[model samples]
Target: MRCDGGKPACQQCVRAKKSDGCEYDDGKGKTRTQIMREHIARLESRIKELESPEITTPPITLFDPHAASPYFSESSSSSSHDSPGTTISLSASASPAPFPIGATADLESAHWDGQWSSMHDFPAVPQIGEPFGAEDPPLELAQMLLEIFLPHRHQCGLELHVGRLRESLTHPLSEQRHPVLMNAIYLWACFLSRPGQLYEHEGLYLSRALAAVNDAIANPAKAVDFIQASCLLSVYFLSNGRLLEGSYHASAAASLALQWGLHQIGRDDFVGSMSSERESTFRLEPAKDSIEQGERILAFWQVFNLDRCWSVALQRPATIPDSKHPWTAITTPWPQRMEDYETGEVDIGPGSPTIHAFFIHQAQVSNAIGGFSTFALHAKAAALLEGASRLSSSWSPQLSTSPSLTDNFRAFEHTITRFTTSLLPLHQLSATMPEDKYSLILIHSLAHASMIRLHEPFLDDQVSRDVALRAARSVTVVAKHIADGDFDYLDPLIGHCWVCAARVLISELAQLQTTWPPANTVDIRGELSTLLFSMNKLSSRFPLLAYQATKVQKLLDAN
Candidate 1:
């Protein structure tokens, strides 16, 4: 038979030969080749039918709600910034978690493999009965308590607990009487009070923490103690969202560390009685020591400098003027100074430092609020970040060759690059706000970063893996902390951490599913659901955030 496409079937050949259509002579069956030919012919006709341009489906419009909403809309703008006088209203109808008081602790234990870990776990707690008092609390313990207790105040509503935490800072704590612990408590109090509408309370705790650190610095014997105390306080400040305060503290800590080194030199000179040969050797010692001390001081400042820069970048106003702002003018450059090991000539790291990693984080926050301006900030940050990454390799040799040093430099470079490239598209979103709009800007940025990890040219590089893992872990740490609500006072940035954790978790899940398949997909959805629920709970504080929460819920549900 002739087909519609003008192809003749084998059956016509059989008929013309005066034989049966069936190729097989066996009783009731056609030969395999004959049956295959017919099947092939049917498939070819079906393929043609499918190949023809589809006409029945409606034309997709740029304005279609389903297709267009993700990319454009006005609702996203409102969620970005919290209005000046907005008060968070908690609905009586909202379901309260069982045992909310200890929820933060429980969540933390679950997240960290029940290690009771805290922010200060980096330098492990000193051995008991070795110099420092065995009973005296470790700085890590203080950090843990702050992280665990702070978020619990949210259960009492933002306004009430913010006041209460502020009040707690004034009362003297006799239990764990180390200067560091007290300062940490003060910092936590400041962090919790600042985020909402209470600026006065925030200042009080910050001032108190600073005072304690200053007092410790004045006493020579207590210098090391105070420096560590101050470092912890500053880190807490930065982590808690008191970026300006955090930056100040970080800078102060850097300066103090330098001063302490100088004081040590003075003490050494005062104590030494110089013989002719010893004096000759010692003359060179001061210069050599000064050089080494300077390098070490710069390295020390590098850590907090990054933190300050990141905080400033994140808090940078969404709007940009024709000319750069003064703060941006002074601080936007990367690696403030690059020290030459041999000659001590300082080269600056980069111009227009990439704020991509930082911006990606802010984008997540903006996405949670549905803020287009915030999203745009992220895009700008990403662009700068990209520029910074390109310039990063030039300073690679300036970084110490120590394994730890090299790894950190590589990680920093990789993180900025990956984060910036992923956020470039978010800049393209039109400036608009919609009613009842919510967007997972954080998740989207993270997803973009994760996509880069799975498919990009940098996948094989160790730095990429390190950056991706660190980013993921940072998110996880923030999420786990927020979920547990363990800190005594809540920082405004706690929500930022939650968003970070969610983004990272989702990114990791996506990566695992793609690369590891059946092995990693298990429990993935459950973990995602838990993170989404946490984001939703946190977002309920602001109406804009509530809308964002709803958006996240839908996104998670669809996924």
Candidate 2:
């Protein structure tokens, strides 16, 4: 059997009564036995020293709350006064710790069996008593939390370049830390911890991140980090059901993205390479390299995707201007995986528009060999769903529908139809990586959810009802896979989609009850149950989902 990497002893060995053999290296050449012997010797020496009773100094706390520690801080002086590559330095707690005692007592050994296994146990509740805010958690604990955060990174946004981030960690913390970004990451890491000590420290990190983000906004050097941190904070709030806070941060991120001209990253250059037809609308600094530039591009889309999708979910107007204004247009290329950026695979020459091009020309540039990736597809899916939702939200029987609006609706429906038809079947979606599977599932689910949202108002019409019914059923089918797979963390907005499907099923069930025989009532009830079950399971970790699941259950009960 494989060792679970449990501390002290692996459970497999302990349960088999071979705990004495469960040995480990202490990172040095010494084995566990050697380390134990040295610890005992040290304890004996400490006892002898205590027996002397000659100590005169009073004992002090291990970590001083008032002590200053080196940390990243923006210079208060004018930006122009600083050199081009000036690095900011500040001091705070060098050993800030959120390590609550007895926090890991309930954590199971098997939970570390694999990366996914560890992530599946979020909010595992190690039962913290009181928090010690004087010291920063050990770097080792931060690294451990980071390992847990990486696999679920996409749940927040795609602003991170994994290879670059991992590489940075190898350097000294003083050289690499961006307080705004690091604290934001630490907040997410704490939130994702499963029965780990950091969970209780989420508030501390959140406050630190928020304060740092405010500072970052004023410092031009920290703009990208500011945007990235805002996106993270937005998702963190939304996941915890703080809609107002989430929306505010999302709006801040989207607005700053426009200010930084992130949406037009390659546009000005791409256009300049071809015809100088377009001049830059926003003054922006050039990225140091493709990876830096690519992160900016991803940052825009991350904000765009979050603003668009969550706007629909929260029934609020989207914050990103998208194609609404010339300056606000998203002419940048579609986002790709960080690896593609590192490999220069996304350098598709100049003048090729991605998001806007896909909408206007139905250009399948994203489907092209090197251009296609799951994230690109997901971006398109978000755009399509948002477009359809906007149209649905505006449509009202009281307002006379214009031919232009009707045509727009038809165009949107046609685009959704084509988009969904092009997707791989659920069974055929890439299953090699679990993250890819999750993305594919969301892509398909969003497509179907769009149909329901678009047709929701006209559900009294037979054709619209039929369309919605089919889409709702399809949602259940895909959601069944999600439930069966036992995914704990998901995009919180997905719960809104689940609620949409449940509403359709509930309506169908209510109507079926009106029929004397109630034909196929069991099937409709079963489908609703499937969606509710999935939502409920996820609700254990996501309070937003719990709220959504409760409303759906009440709807079912009423029906």
On TM-score, the candidate that comes out on top is 2
lDDT of each: 0.35, 0.66
After TM-score superposition, the amount by which residue 39's alpha carbon in candidate 2 deviates from its true location, in angstroms, is 24
Candidate 1, residues 124-237: lDDT per residue as tens digits? 211111111211123433333343334332221111112323343344432122344344553443333333222222333333344345445545544444544555555554
> What C-alpha lDDT, on a 0 to 100 scale, does residue 42 get in candidate 1?
55
Q: Judged by lDDT, which candidate is best?
A: 2
Q: Model 2 misses residue 396 by how many Å? A: 1.7
Deviating ranges (above 4 Å) for candidate 1: 1-202, 211-218, 258-529, 535-559
RMSD vs true structure, all candidates = 29.9, 12.2
Predicted structure 1: lDDT? 0.35
Off by over 4 Å in 2: 1-136, 170-177, 269-282, 348-353, 365-371, 483-486
TM-score of each: 0.29, 0.75
For candidate 2, give the lDDT.
0.66
